[model samples]
Target: MAQGEPEAEILLNTIESQTLAVIDRLNRAILMLVTGQPTVSGYSAMVGTLRPSFDQIAQYAPRWGDLIPDAPHIRAELAYLLSQRGPLDRLQTPHLWAALGLDQESVRQIYQSRYGDLPSSERTRPTAAAAPKTEPPSLPWIDASLFQSLQNELQPIYLPSGKALFRQGDPGDSLYLISNGRVKVVVGEGETAKTVAEFGQNALVGEMSLLSGGNRSASVYAIRDSELFRLPKASFERLVEHHPRLMLEVAKVISTRLENATSGKPRADQALSLAVIPAGDGADLGAFCDQLVESLRTHFDCAHLSRAHLDSALGEGIVDAPLGTLRESRLISWLAVQSELYPCLVYSADPTLTEWTKRCIRQADRVLVVGEGRGTPDLNPIERALFEGDSFHPEIRKELVLLHQGGQAPQHTQRWLAHRQVADYHHLDPHNRAHFDRYARFLVGRPLGLVLSGGSVRGFAHIGVLRALREAGIPVDIIGGTSAGSLIGAQAAMGWDDVRMEQENKALFKNVRRLIDLTLPVTSFAAGKGFSSLLKQIFGDHLIEDLWIKYFCVSADLTAAQLRIHRTGLIRRYVRASSAIPAALPPVLDDGHLLVDGGLMNNLPVLPMVEIIKSGTVIAVDVSNPFYTADGAYNYGDPENGDSLPFGKVLRGRVLSRTLVTPSLVGILLRCLEIGTINMESVQIPKVDLYIRPPVDDIGSGDVSSMDKLIQLGYETAHQQLKGWKGRPPA
Candidate 1:
């Protein structure tokens, strides 16, 4: 050991002790001042009263040079106080404000407002640049005693002076904290070797690589016979689970080293790579690639590359890249460079999975597998590699994404892919491309879409159900709606997050009477000003054409007798038309045409959504049920023998008009919406069809019992359906 080692150790130990004492005093003093919540009138008086504690902090502050490595402003503030004379009041100097991390112009304004004198500042020096920001949930530095106790939990090892701890380029499997003696960090071979840094007691080594999941950047050797607490990767991860603050401290240490290594400017690459693959037969690879490329290009505004590959047998027709039997390593290297440049690189898999295709899958950070509805693909060699052989990389499943051709996945497929993500497929439409924009932000393996069906007040129950799904982290990427569903769907599509939607739902239901015209019978005209007012309150008076989600609002043109799916327009227009109950409220006039409720034609707009989405799964939350029969089928209201039919079914066509005359005008008008349609039977796409049957005979009542029942059903259904998927440990 060096002659000065004991003195150096004693000095460090004293500094650590004093530093902890200062921190304790500072925290108490700050809390004491903040508790009273002093106003500006007594602010200066409070500062004067806390002068003694402040002096103590200033007295011990110099010893914290190493303890507070990142806070230059704090150090500068302390230095100015150490040189001060009288009480700290009426001294509005620019340097003093700068030392407290305030800008010169802001300080100048404060000085002009208070002290009334702008003092000549000839001796002021520039303040140091603020510390680089760290990702949040920051923690205070641990005291030496607490740090030592943490080390006691790990196994200790001793090494001779000449022993090497680790070599550059080796896998970083552990980190070492010096208990005694010192270690030297070195880089390069013997001829070019240079010392990078040195560490002594309590200093950590090899933490950077361990935290980053990278190789060691330098070699470490004990300069003297040393005792070290060896924290293996497993032990470190276990500690992280309990003490997440340890990650921040480790980041601080690494940031210091990195700042020095790069002369205070380290450029870290923040980009990620993704690969898309097909998981079933007859899947459209070209459409999937185009969707992925367009989504990435539009969202990130960066180049999105897709390499269209073909088997050697079909090489004659291949246009993108003709693989002329080159070396596999060289090809991989070229692809790796392309990946570094582009945020997303989609590789179109050949009909036959080859060794080269598997290599591409292996290189990706994430892989999305596209498949049609209800079908699971046979395990190819690449997929088989995920489970078999000595390399049992279970993480391969985490990378796997099952994007359904339609919105729904079969029960068997869902069970088989319990660990993987299931996402919804989306089409490229100019008006609905906002769905891709919102989806690209998450960059998730499993993307989701929401489908809402109309059923007047019953749709409120659907909203509660959607809230539960969102709380469970089941992503909802886009929304498609019909009638009352359009009202709820527009709120979601217009960027109303869970908290906002829940609040609005409660507020709207509380004043349900204001939205219902009591003077009129229960007909289409019964919708009052309160519904329009609530819509305006929820989504302001603006056309949300550039919203983050792609939405479909279905409304039928009575004049044209054509079903219209409006994507881009004033949201109010769609909501008004979709909510236009025939014979009850006036038909909504849009683009000089009269449009009625879309539910009259297609109550469950799932088939329309399924037709457009080229890839991915969909979540169809149906609130509409043309009343269910005893046999669990739709009750298509018949008017035979003076039976009063549901209002919507009556408007289907002239074929039913001959027998659809009302038996009791007022009674039928009030109970018209009670009859259910055959919309569910018409649905051909496989999806999550949630049929919400309110416990009451009347579906449109906004009573508490009905709303509560719907909310409970939604909560129970969400928790049950997402049982196998939610809150599992990461793969």
Candidate 2:
């Protein structure tokens, strides 16, 4: 019954007729329409049909709904189809938002707000034009009604190529949504634009930084002529309550872009939202807390009620505002106050509330389990079921993984699950026991991957371990189980879903994932919380496309260039299909040696990481990993004569392995054998995805200087052993 639904269904049918590659292009074209800058763009007849375009997109990504913008010709067609003609024309003017109806007077006043109080003459840095008109919404969460309201409220502006829209770290004053032209986002501490993401009409920007009052995560500049709408914070918040669905939809689009541009690692803005919020008990807490109690209330009921009921309920003495508006505002204000007082964070979940809890475990100094394995009326209906039991095995039970589970791990877990199979390795093979201890050694130099799961909170001892890890530069990714603070590492890594972080936070997560996938080596992770069920519910048949593998860049450890160098050796060969490993890249090293391997993974030219063993004096060497095959398939390179194949050279029959290698230990061993500085010198580590930061469990005896507690823990001894590794290549 909404304004666009009937028309939307018709559009979807048309998109279904397109070829697969065309679908992706169509998706981009539609996005360009919504995000394009209006004021400076020259509209073409070919670009004006909203209806036909919507119908085309509807054909393919139907459930994607009308939030998906229409391509030029299709948008024009849709305008005529909806009997809403003038608005869909490709124009750089006020007609776009004006056709829907938003506040003009409030808008213009905001334009000259003098963000830096520049002189009136100095303020002329290419002003934004009048925006489309939009009035206040008549109903909450209804897309069409909100659209109508926003139609009455904006001043449009067009940006030309090379135009500086805003700078990174700039103060936030207003939010802009593209209407006509394309703009590119440049990130990385204002150094240079490394990864460029383009946004056209309907794409939103500036909201996340504005709302959080944080410095801009990435700078924005125009590429082509652009039409835009400026939405200040107050108006944005007002629109959020009245039209929650619209706000959420806008966010999803932005998030998708950032994720695509940076691989999986989000921009700095997103990184914060995903990180764990600290947890600590207030010493002066408890007793009568009125303000703290008020926030948990909601006004969803008030918004849906009839005017008559509201009039009777509040009477004439109340302020003359919309009944729904007043009630929602009251609830929001109360909730905000409570959040401030409690100093606790909360988040809404999709299938189950796990992301929030995951964060709590990561940051909490201590946790107290206060439940009795069940819930009563005292807790919310959903709360009891989520928190009343253990859903996962403990983070560390010493050694009881396979025993508790019904069956042995399939072939997948073989190499990954080898050690720690017994409570004590005393009776195990000497080599295997040493292998277990190698984990500790690997952890000493590199950061560790600390994951958390389940419902109940762990004791302070666990928190202490996490702190130690953090101090050692370990990057923890907590996968939250249902209940309490469920926001965990992956969510933090990806940011929240389309509906969660609004637009800004979503963009942050998307960027994080982009960088993560592109930079790190990706290995498959076992699904948790029945991810298959969640994937099916949301993405339908194409779960592989929807469930993405993202890469995250750790800022503290490495520079972007170093990371790019490492990633260049990887990415190009990825087979993009669901079965994993691209067809273009065959296996290069099933033999498992780092130094000599048969076959290159991809034919692309790359600098492979050469291995260095302690041979007294062997200069650092660089090897190439170009998936070349001279005989093409049969690689009989023979490193002795340097006869190689186009695919790769098979130097040896098998690699000698000490087994159980950690990333950090390898880094140190490689460095020491190459005669690189082993002493402490400030060095930054470049980031890559899927590689877990090793935890510091022991210290080497040779480490000198002001040894910290970790160093005293004997983590360094093993670290030295790993650095001075005198083993043959893995065999």
Candidate 3:
């Protein structure tokens, strides 16, 4: 017997005990079915609810397959019942029993044996449900030998009851697998501590931090005297080398806990990684590429490699080396030649690769197409190169947009880019090494606070911004939004893709135009419910709590004369309330006060984001296009009188009307120039690292077709903003 055999036996026994408890529940349910007056519908519902629990218990104890007779047939019966619709009485009971391979008499006898007796009157009827057929082996069974082998690789540590294994925010470098007793997972500290879950023997803990290589998100404390197998990162890595399945298991556990923690849907990162920056003809593409390489080298432990360098380094080792460091130099040279062996390799867009850029594009997870401000490079050759690749790279579907440098968008550039089905960026400065460095840090691994500024129909540009970020592989961990931005931010929090969002936005605007009952007059609040209904139809039953990322919507409370950041409520309602421009829609009522759009008072919404995300450096994306060169290009607001405003004359509804409505075009332009420019001085927040104000002017037409230009601008701006940001592979 192995050294850990006894402990493994104990673990198996505990799991068996839990399985038996589940069986007991099943037996009791059967007893009620035999004697109790349960309608066929009610009985079917009971079975439906209980079936999953049986499967869950079975997963924990695979041996249940042997112990539980007729389990397979029972599972089949349950499945069949679940698949059927409408009245249950329409089916033949005997045919169901035969198909389920169940004997009613046997079930009643077993139920009667366990619960003393069944009602005499009920026994005369068809004997309820029977025991399930023997289940087939399903769960991945960890035998004594496997357990002992794993134990030999890890150090066993014992802790007294009430002792902590690890605390929230503590640096973690080890995985803890419980050998005995239990542990409680807690979040927060001191009086604010809250228990999230408790796990017993054989359960894994601390894997989240171990996999992420970050501080613990929560704390684990021993609920009782416990024994744990502590596997150091080194040992776990070795184990994964030999048993790859173990890694998948660990990922599953971590994913489950994360889903529960954030109330987000289960999601995995995309495999295809490529960012294409079109450095125009005038732009120095090589210098820009070198800067990106340097920033990545400074931040991540990575080095650049070209085909020539790789061949030369492999064939002829470095000749110039210090006496003592000859071996170190040779090793680095060898590794450079063998870059494919490393877990991560970030390369530059070598001009040489341009000859095979199309083939390279197929192989790469991400590709950055650098072009001039005028338009994209001749894509015909690149597209032709893609056809030469034997096998398509999994991430080939990743972004392939044109990144422009300097100047306003060229007239022909839009047509050219749209023809290639690619987006364009004109806001990035290739010379800004400092911004690239920060962007590199963001790309490698940095939490971001995404602040979305309200811009009504103009907000469609934000989709391009999100697409660029997604392509670059930068994830926004926290979000704040105002008015139309709140709608975009909510979608981000829900993990909606950029393409889907763009399509939905186009559909929404079309619906808005058609649904507005102009016959009823604009001042009568006729469009409010229809608009709200549209939002509901699109968002469905999603709540603010359903947001995968921490998020808040900004709105102004008219009665309180205050800006409010709402964190929890119906997501559609929150968006509607935040977008309630005085005369445009009805004011949303909350806590006896009416609230309208936050843009009038807080158009930028930086403070609300700063308030929620206190610790990390905040990177904000300010989308509000408050500046316009010409009066015709400017978007203006109307008068906000109670009679004219659809939100009503309650509390301080007219507060913004009195304070914010500036009639002078010169004054509005000046204020826009003052507030619209994004800089540290303007924001006044010490923690803010980067605040981006994309080049977008107001569009008064609100034309749906005009959105393509805004989206293109957004794409170009976001792509430029993420100049040094790069995507990372799944951990």
Candidate 4:
């Protein structure tokens, strides 16, 4: 007996009661049908009612086992009933009894006991159809084994329809994982209560308050009869302690919620007002606003309201207007009401300190502080004062938007972002339509995400592709990758431009042989210590969340048998984990899980990006090798053949000979991995808006000697692929 055993018993009893009630309803419906009442609708309704409960029991039956001995049988019967299309008129009375797992004699005896004698109509009924089999839906995030391990600690709770799970302002002690039915999240109460979101089976709710150590922000109620496993704070903390990546996933959910709250999904009548103010002198605010408005018009009914336009439209002369004046309040009210007319409104603030600028700032729901990327990253005095002032509305979202003239990497961005309390930051070439489009997507709460695919040393090509994207003046709001892409994406997120990455790649692989430290034959050929050291040298102790851009990396968790997305932990450790190639390099054990290359599961991890961003243009750069065939020759003019070779080629061959020997067991495993990865990419690539497959198939995964060539190929491939984006030829 445990501390919560009584509660668990009570929950089980309640479930049994519900199950019996449903069975009683089903039996009565069947009896009615046999009596010539032909209660098809009643039978169908009972089957529908049994579905959620069946799903709930099915999910937890393995864990509960003997506690609910009849769960499996009930579930099977429910499956059959739910699968049936037509009425009970088709099913024979005896067959129906058997299909429902009720013995024919028992059903007749029960019918005789309840009503009168069994009706003769049962004899003429049609034969019962066989139950259709169904496979369970895949839930990659939920670890069944993990839950089984915590079975004793887990408390099962039944939430009936319209019942509150927890109300706003209640103490948050646990989070619930919905096993069945749907729940709606609401804020306020009575007439003011508004349903903000609804979550169904397998959705995690009540985690935010548990993580933040605060009272519940909203009330959650069961929209239907639901079964949930409540994991208390203590158990959750222990789970997180053993599986740190779970924290990362939770953080991502929180980040998504915050993003949604700040910039909700764009609607036809949703008025998203944005104020574009200069960060410093000579920001070219007009050009920036014009380009932004143009880009926004592609997706939204956008209107650019400058000072003159506002004055003309509202007839509110902004001549030396004070902050708290009645005219200012009236103007603000009028602007706020414009949301019903337009989907988006862009307010272009005057560069200098003026009444119009102040009004613009006051009226906006969001503010973009535009600055010249090439100039000193400093805020104008008036803007600085307002930002730091108590009078500034705390709820108004602010973001720094740095403008560049040409397709150059952002300059002095770190200095600008160092202490600035903004929701986000972006680098845009004012003249580039692509940049504006990307920003426009950001404004509408849809952001562009870039997913870099893993291909060992071939991932250096990602640098070149990144270079091309930068040169094309396309902004990446979020980035994710697996294995080698993790390494490259981390550096990119840390603000390493392509040139720096290329230089670093060359330097790191200067002595390619040093990367391998052969270990015991049990785990891996290499211990991966050297590789880990290299990653450590590069990223140090930087956190993934602390990167210049929002970044995440994926790793295959061998312990949990699922892919883990690392978004908040130490960058070096997760990168090491993500790049831990099976057999070639030993898996990295972090907080009890053996994590290997994420390429094993998801070579091109576009799903994480899509999941986080919700709706946006997702660009996936796949540097994965094509599927290998056994018939393909590995020998490139064997030395025994006496083929003439250039001195440079001979030197390169000798250097790589030690690392890239004839395809052995490791080579076979890598090939198999690649085959699986390619199949996965085939499915994932189509989900993205753009897929850039660089011509690096000729290059071997272990080939780092031709870094420059690989990078150049990547750059050329990306440029050619994206040339149509700018409606111009590639430079």
Candidate 5:
């Protein structure tokens, strides 16, 4: 491409490779700066493969010179070349950019010559990196050949149609690789068994044990004695140590599995009941319609006796089939739903419908009433009246759900009685605002109050909210920023004050509580008392012994730290024997470092659940540390949920006139309004306002747990100095 193109590429490649040499630590600092991996090699390989915009930025803003006359890190030669804005201000020392052999001027020139000047907003800060256009999973190497070299290490097993391979509680250090055959993973506490997942050949049973080095997280049993190639702990460890690329493939699979296991079934919005007791003199014609509503709600909500599972409807029994059961019913119904864009109803001719019709309307998709075929035009009198008014649609197409409101049962209701079909119902509505509203009633807050923002247009509605909150001196946590957030950049921008930061420290810790609860398998059958207790165990006095002497950094995988320059990165924490966690009344500092630095030390725990649901709470939603997505989804390794580590939430409080209406301001203003009550309790920080409250973690397991098991599990037993425990004699 150019005379020096290969040299430039090679230089970039070497930096990428060296940077990956410290992947575990690098993840903490440079997660979003580079894309595609938490693994060093994985990230380096991607660097060689994809030319990220950062590279362009680097070329455009290359360092000024090799040596600095004054403020070496900010040298004139380097500043003259690289400093479009002037000076390398980030490094603690001057001339450090030169020391790193980076020329900011060259990077700036490269960017200008090729991509041109970046947006004014983007050019202001070196840290203001452009987000990768690719989805995180689709970034690369998720399903790539990174793992192809280790194909032989993966053994396959096949099982007969009905046989048991491993019974529950059978001790095994190896994880099975499924080649073929059906298998079931059943989990429960004595007698009450729930199959977490059904596996076919090529599935895994005890991979979690191999991943975390603990006993099987869940007891696995073969529904049918299936044949599988099992990866022994030794083989798996060797692969991970030598062939780190292979670890990335497993990370993708495991992260996805973890998300799936926790989310159980795709959630649906609750259906509103349209109940009419009937006109007194005219008789209760709407009674049948009311019954119809009840029946439909049960079907849509997927209600049942034991479990609310949606698929339970298809038991061999007698009951009405669900609505609109047909081959192309969904397509037909979608036509009507599409026509009803302005929020009016539609009716059909025959009244009979198909499964697709119900699906289409429920999902906010377009619907079409096909009543013209059966002389039962799908219009209700109310809908007809509305159509006649200002909002009428054309006489041909319309959006209608209840085609047969004429006191009659639709034909499709029999499918539930006739056949039990738990459809996958392929779609991405789970992230839609309309779809999320379906689960509104069940959510913590009723009449859900959302400070929605972010979009190419409508940026100010939320900004107004932030400005007012700033004015009121209120501590506010935020979530997704869009149409509204665009205007209210102040709250996000100005959330750096001290008093605000002080009050928010506890609030942030409380959020840290939620992060841990959400991330950990506290709901697992293996976990006896929920996630809070499990976190306590990890961060507790019962932690691996002698964690007393040094700082412990958090990484997705602890062992990956071996790739670090020093032997220091692997320690989970320096737990002094019998030392208590910093449970000070408030504003507690850590390792002599004030964890909350007014603006620094922000451990933003990105909220996956909230992003999926699209809420607007910083902690309740998702957040990156100091860096976060424009829409506010978090991206990174798991530092927020690290063992008992607290986080800080920074809030913005600025005053704004009512006349200055922006989406961001609107978000802040709306927070003060009493929209409704929320049933949700924050999972972080345990609602702790008092200093006496025990840390949400547990510290009493060392004396009670078997020493042999602890050693075998690779967890050194912390001293049994917990206030309530007496060392029990080991059996």
Candidate 6:
């Protein structure tokens, strides 16, 4: 060997041995933090051990920067840990544990196991003191004292299973309050009888009869052994006199039940009959049916009876006669029997088979028109005639389901929709089993709502997110937004694809001067005319109600001091109102109300989407300012020569430096607005099925120069986060 080769090898081995020892210490420290009891002394020892190991690891960060790129992040986490006041403080801080690569939920559970739930002061953080110290308003129906009073005037009765509480047409003398078990409310009798509603604990039953002073509307029977408190008619009248709100609450329930019965929509507990019909030739109708049936079987007792299945049944004498030979009444009876046999019945129909298709359509609660997304969107003459003819029921919900292969974006969907009266549309990948499962959940009436948060220029990131979602085949059935989100969401609702949106955003933001209309700063810095003109150029007098997708935007109403959701109005006007930043742009006057930027209140607007869908998959994209620690905000300084910090820290430092060095009135107002919005997002984001926070913390809300970068960041973030997003069904 060459001279000094043996000595060099000995030196390298010595260094490797020292490094492995440091790693071993670091692993033990992390394990102790994760698995050890969260005692102050134990955690303190862990922190003490972790500090020197982290410092030792950080010394090698520069040499392995490219190989172990998360070095800077680890350093920041270590910095955060060392900055904590005490072990108790560190244990209480969930974010610290999360930053240190510990499971946040497990940390919370461990902390709570020792300390119970976090107090209100800890839960609200900085805003805890701002919360009003008053008892929350209570409703009469939920008041414990009111319930106790009512119970004092009534006697409890035990109900045995299969026993009738009261028969239909019985005189309305009393109302029963169910304290335990379950009961079914039925109408008619024997084979004609139907259980229209069911009640369990805390439910008020037979209130309709008592309130109307008439015979019972339905027979109440105990399906399970139960206990009920009986309030006589005289007592109920006296109670209503003392508590007027109770009558109103009961009336509200009755009104809701009456409306539901008259609406012709099935109850939540009822079975669903769906018919899948191919719209055009070459559509994989059989395969789609099989996949759908398989997907539905995951969450439902599903039965698939295609034309072939029916033929087999008829040949086996399971069906008495051929469907063609059966009378209309008999066919209806058979369809009803199938619906009763399964929680979900899927009828796969061939468009060419006019009689068979008609039968399926007639029996269906909903009809799914399946088409190849890339193929011609035209419907066959037979299909069109069957759908439009007198035989087709107008009440049957018709929705378009476009199947794609190889991750193709939906094309010519509007054309396909025009062929028939479709309530909504969906894009599906035939080869993706997960896609089929998602579609099945949608069929069960759990839709997907996409919420885009507002961050002015940062909103451009939403375009990239939309691009990634389309590419990943994530469906967005309803969309809601605020401020900048409204501008982007309007385009999306207007059917602007990701590419088109990207092109439009680039063209619009290329020259920022076009968006400015400088005026005297009495009300705002700009007159808002420029922004209005820009919106007009894109929307051209279209109504919000006329958007291709179901959409809404939120705006802060200054007159009412409340948030307004604009689902119907002139599109440009409402969007302009929603985007009007207070002190920067003038408030918009619409429908006799002055509206300002919705970011002043709800920047994410997820709650409105939740209210609209009632039950659905909600995916929220937050492009708001990135969160920073107090230490990161104040202690951040320039790194030494040849030393590099994490990209996040660098971005945060830049933003903080600019704000702290030379703060302006507009900047202060905007910062406050951002803080409030961030707090609100924390609450709303958890309610959604998926929450996407793009890596654009360094990009300021007003920074329009790096629109391309922001978009790319959003695209990458969404693609990474949605890798395992198989949306949940409605609760």
Model 3 lDDT tens row, 31-78: 221222111232222221233333233222332323222433333333
The full ranking of all candidates by TM-score, starting with the best, is: 6, 4, 1, 3, 2, 5
Models, CA RMSD each: 25.1, 25.5, 26.4, 23.4, 32.2, 29.7
How many residue-pair clashes does candidate 5 contain?
Answer: 127
Q: What C-alpha lDDT values do all the predictions have? A: 0.51, 0.28, 0.52, 0.66, 0.29, 0.65
Which regions in candidate 1 have their CA more than 4 angstroms from the true location?
A: 1-446, 518-524, 625-680, 685-705, 725-731
Worst 10 residues of 5 by lDDT: 596-605
Q: lDDT score, residue 58, model 3? A: 29
Better of 2 and 3 by lDDT: 3
lDDT (Cα, 0-100) at 498 in candidate 2: 19
Q: What is the model-wide C-alpha lDDT for candidate 3? A: 0.52
When 3 and 6 are scored with lDDT, the better candidate is: 6
Count of backbone clashes, every candidate in sequence:
19, 146, 30, 0, 127, 0
Model 4: colliding residue pairs:
none
Question: RMSD to the native, candidate 1?
Answer: 25.1
Candidate 1 local lDDT, 1-731, one digit each (tens):
43323433443333334433333322322212222111123222221122233333333434333332123333333323333431222232333333333344544454444444343434343344222111111124434433333433455566656578999998888876554445778898689988766555445677665677678889987755555666677766776677676666556656765664554221121233454565544266566566656766643334333344433422333223334321222243234334323435556554445544454454444455555434564654544554343332233323333344333312233333443333332322322344444445445322355677766666766667677776776556667888768887888766677567667787667856677664455445565466667777766654534334557788878888888787756678678787777776678887788887787766657666654442334566656533323422324444565655666656763465554333344224323432333434444334433333333345443354376666666566656666664322111
Off by over 4 Å in 4: 1-271, 274-333, 340-342, 346-440, 630-663, 672-676, 725-731
Best candidate per TM-score, number? 6
Whichever of 1 and 2 has more lDDT, that candidate is 1
Worst 10 residues of 1 by lDDT: 130-139
Per-residue lDDT tens digits of candidate 4, residues 1-731?
Answer: 32333433443433433433333322322222123121234232222123334433333333333322233233233323322432332233333333333334544454344334533446455444332221212235535444333444457677866678999999999877654445788999999999777665445678666577789999998755566767688876787787676666566655664565454331121236678888865487777788888888877678788877767865557434455543444454344334323557788988787777776675565789888877776667657755777545543568888877776655456677764678777777777776677667777756778899888788999999999988987767778998888999999888788889999889988988888999896998897888888888898877775564678999999999998999777899999988888888889888999998898888888877776666566788988765446434454455667855456765687787733224545456655556656676656666677888898988877778879988999999999888876322111
